[model samples]
Target: MKLLSRIDIRQLRILSSLLQERNLSRVADQLGVTQQAVSDQLKKLRETLDDRLFIRTSNGVIPTPYAESLQPKVEHILAALEDLLTPQTFDPRTVTRTLTLCSTDLEQIVILPKLLKILRREAPGVRLAVKKLELDQLSTSLLTGEVDLVISNPDFAPPSYPSLSLYPEHYACVASKANKTVRKQMTVEQIAQIPQVVVSPSRGDFSGAANSWFEQQGHPRNVVLSVPTFSAAKACIAESDICGFIPARLLPDARLRVIELDADVPGFEVIAVWHNRSSQDPLHQWLREQLLAVATTP
Candidate 1:
């Protein structure tokens, strides 16, 4: 088999579209060309491949066996070519662009406030939209351009995208003053037995570092309820015996008492992720720097 050239691949894509639509006119409409243009391209495609790539059937055009076999390779090559041709760089200060970021509520509550403040003060023209995405979807979203950046737990494996650790935060058990059992610190067993409000922000299976530590010591926690937001869990904890695992840095003025976990649960890092294609773009670079500075500052 001969190696397909770039022109062959482009023609293959046009042929693929015709196969999908069946009607030459419809394919031409989609491609912003006339029916004659579509027919010409189809002729070129058939001659180049030396095969009837698509055959007109009663319903529509049907791809031949050869075309069927080449479809996957052709699609992959065209996608790669599209990526190669797409412009990746962005300029923050000058570009009036909206960047979509996927992150948990924890990042919204802790990091986004400061980050947005910096954007307002520095990059007034830039707009930010934040969405809460499940952990499983982060990598796919980055690859598909559904999200421009992802701020998530360090435990999440960095995808093909470039990522940087924004900051580190320790886990602390927080409860209301009215909760009599946990005043300062609670033992592993005590923590296990308590009515715990688990915060699974990303619909992640593991509860948190504190829960992981307890389970590692052969003591699994009795999570009474699982909430999506740390604030909601905190609110639930403030009114009842429910205790929540929260980031240590989130302990300033909330009406909850934060106690260090008895187990040596190491702090987790927060990461800022973006596609390598956009990593060096001036706007993305500036936004990343602002996020890091905000996350690290006291």
Candidate 2:
């Protein structure tokens, strides 16, 4: 059977590291190997690949076209291998580590406040980094450990990672008090006839199940404005006659009134996701528990 040996893997890894650091000595130090060992590996790599992968210069080694071409594939393979070998176990009480989370702005505004408070009291040393992640990259981001957890609407397909439903949030049609067109309640037909604002993170089009509900009810709303965030939609609603659908939990402010939809629109299920390998991790488990607790609170 044809096989790339483990030594080949090690050599590729070393080559990739050297390309990144641009200094053989630094790469050698990181790898805990002598500079001669790195040079010997580089020589074997050049023989195996039959190309001058790197050109030595006065400053440092510069990658040849061949080396540049191999960088991405090598990095991906190395990342995948590293992910495979990463320890899944974690101890929250003993471990002082940062957990990276990917979530939407609405979720960050609504959920993270309480979660941060709890974390500060419970795990004082642990840190958190929250990044806005677009829906298209959610699955791969979780799989690759780009983010430890993703809090997203469960309507989107559950990522390859292990996921659990946090809570259900219903859609509400919101309008400013000054807008005389919509009152406390809006029928499906009435809502469809009004100028609407749509919120979508990816396409900036109608969001969640709103489009599906409109189509199912045989009435499509005319979307006058499209924005990338729920807050933008709410702002549009507050500024004009345009009404938009948003999560029910986002109703703390008095600038807009959330009206119930006459048509049966499906509620959004919020989910917390983590890599399958991290399902048993104590830190991940604690984070999930804290998030779930915050979600459950009235």
Candidate 3:
């Protein structure tokens, strides 16, 4: 260890160049130092290594067996050190790592398709693994590097982590086209009286955000069923005479018709959240930018 401690990068480079050029004057000019400077460094190298690495010749110098044996190892060491000193850069085009995302089915349905299209085109090699949002395990997963990003509305976003707002989401009252109870246009009172399905992805209760909005206006919605995801709720509402609040982005499907409401519906902001450790990560930042663009896109 002390033998290596006495040797430094400057001497190593001088040795590397001297081995290649086999001449003191050439090594001096190549390293932008004088022949005497090269001689002084070579002297130090010889003392540290306990071997006269080269033999002075009338023409220049010839490498000894010990110096010849070190040529490959010295080159390897310099290359490794040079690589270690360089800063890492992110290039989406060449990325091949899998990015694990945690989000509810609503985001997986409404937001992920648009994001995937961009990813497939720009970062062809970057794979994606989507995990359903589990509130109880979210903080541990995020902090332990198991989850890369979380996409959710304010109600579901983890309270302890910082988040970036992607966009605002409004809900529309929708009913199956076959449903006969809905009128041409209904008051919130009339709509609240009909059978309703509320989406509560992380909870099993037949309650949801729409209940609060309905209760605020003094017309609590009649909840007949609960589903775990927006996609599941959409499926149930399309086949049954049930009405539920659906995000505006998932509207215009032929299976269901938007029910005109006499009252204004409430909306929430969607956001991307991450642990503080990833606040400056290039991949996370890029993903957030893509999500923002996708959510804001027409």
Best by TM-score: 2
lDDT on C-alpha atoms for all candidate structures: 0.75, 0.79, 0.85
Candidate 3 ranges beyond 4 A from true positions: 1-88
lDDT of 3 by residue, 121-228 (tens): 999988899998876777767755679888887777679888999888899999888888886688999998999998876776887888888999899889999887
- What does candidate 2's lDDT look like per residue over 200-220, in tens digits? 767655544587778788988
Question: What TM-score would candidate 1 get against the native?
Answer: 0.73
Clashing pairs in 2: none
TM-score of 2: 0.74
What is candidate 1's lDDT per residue for 1-298, written digit by digit as tens?
4534525654766765765566777888887878887778788777776888888877768878887787556645655666677467655556778999988788898888998888887778888889985778876666545688998876775656678888888777778878888868667787788888777776744465566677788889887788777778778889998787778777754588876666666678889887655654567777888888988888
TM-score-better candidate, 2 vs 3 = 2
Per-prediction count of colliding residue pairs? 0, 0, 0
TM-score of every model?
0.73, 0.74, 0.69
Winner by TM-score between candidate 3 and candidate 1? 1
Least accurate 10 contiguous residues by lDDT in model 2: 1-10
Report the lDDT of model 3 for residue 257: 88
